[model samples]
Target: MTIELYTWGTPNGKKASIMLEECGLDYSVHPIDITKDEQFGAEFLAVAPNNKIPGIRDTDTGLTLMESGAILLYLADKAGKLMPTDGEERWRATEWLMWQMGGFGPMLGQAHHFHRFNKGKADYAEERFLKETQRLYGVLDKRLEGREAIAGSYSVADVATWPWAARFEWHGVDLDQFPNVKRWYLAIAERPAVQRGYSVPSAQDIPMP
Candidate 1:
């Protein structure tokens, strides 16, 4: 059986879609336009009580999973390719995923909120998020200094964090200051699958603004 993926075009939603494509999994993408409040509807909220995109249902396992981190783990387990099976390697993968959830996710999310989504003078919010984001970027840069792909392998950890780091330019975070991170982000961003995942939606759905 196939998986049903309910998601939109945002970063969190794209995480699952990219994983699906990378794993060569058979799935359906349901575009939920958050601007029109589709994610808050009854049906969507049922699968995702928090009414968020990136929730998926596995027909084979009869499991409904939400959150990008959780979905990545589920798909990794299903694919048996990008995830480690035992020992410290497995824990390391899990640690990086948690880093995304706890560090990158929150910091970048707040940056987006204040920079793009703010309607008023939310200077404090913007500054706070940007500072936190920079700190997190430093941590990532240090981690990637002598390594490749977060955990020495191109696993879900890199996949999970790449989008967040990629958004730094959009959020006014200087990439030049962090050479290692810039290299890592650009390398992942240049991949064919990453390019394909970013182009999932049709031209008509794209906003002129």
Candidate 2:
């Protein structure tokens, strides 16, 4: 059986699709066009109460799930691939993944909204988001100072946060300060799986920028 992923091109949505691709899971992508408010429609709302993208229905198990983090964890558990088997390593990866879900995703999402999508340039909004975005980048940078991936492995935790790091410039957050993140970002972004995963929701281009 195959998994069906309803997703958009946003960071959170990309996280799940990237994981599915990296795991070599057979799946289909149903692009939920946020611009057209497809997520708010009845069909999507049935799959996800929050009417959000990045949801899945597992035909093999008859389990339907929402929220990117939950979906990532579920997929990881199902595949037993990206997550660590050891208690300590698994906990470490989970903690960082939660950090990305709670801290990084929200802050950077707001930064993108205020900095790029909002009407007019709001200095206060920019300052607020940039400060938090920079702080979050610093946190990740320190965590990755000498590491190759988050939790010392290229797991779901790393995939979950990769898109945000790649899109830092859009949030007015500089990459030079987070050299370690930059290194990891370059490595992951260049991966064949990541390339394919990141391309699913893109109807035209695969975000070369």
Candidate 3:
């Protein structure tokens, strides 16, 4: 049975779609136009109480889920792929996932909002978030100094964070400044499943705010 994916094409939304694609899961995409406030509708709120895009309902198990990080982990476990089964490797993956959820994604999101979308400059907010975003990029670069993937493997941690890094230009990031992240980002971008996932809901479906 196919999962019903309620999502848009933004970073968080792309995480779920990318994980599903990587797991070879059958799914149907339903675009949630956040720009039009579709995410706040009661129907969507039933499954995603936080009124966020990237929720999913699993037809095979009647399970509904929200939060991109949690969804990625669930899909990874279900597929028996992408995550380490036990011990240090497993915790390591979780550590990076939390790092993305708590810091990277949120900082970049604020940078995007203030730098690109805000009506006025909002100087303080813009600078604060952008600086933080760049700092987080540097952190990732240091972690990837000699590694191909975060957590030492292409696991859900990568799935959770790559989309955000992929939008470096939008966040005013120069990949050259973070060469390791640039290398890792380019490597993941070449994956066919990632390419497909990044295009989910289609470009035309994304509405302007």
* lDDT of all predictions: 0.79, 0.85, 0.89
TM-score-based ranking = 3, 2, 1
Show pairs that collide, candidate 3: none
Residues 61-92 of candidate 2 have per-residue lDDT tens digits of: 87899999899888988988899987888999
lDDT of 3 at 138: 94
lDDT leader: 3
Show model 2 residue runs off by greater than 4 Å.
119-122, 203-209
lDDT of 1 by residue, 22-123 (tens): 788888777788989998998788778888887888989888888889899999989887888888878888899899989888778988888778825788
Reference-based TM-score, model 3: 0.95
Instruction: Give the lDDT ranking, best first.
Output: 3, 2, 1
> Candidate 2 overall Cα lDDT vs. reference?
0.85
Off by over 4 Å in 1: 202-209
Winner by lDDT between candidate 3 and candidate 1: 3
Residue 87's lDDT in candidate 2? 88
Query: How many clashing residue pairs are found in candidate 2?
Result: 0
Tell me each candidate's TM-score.
0.91, 0.94, 0.95
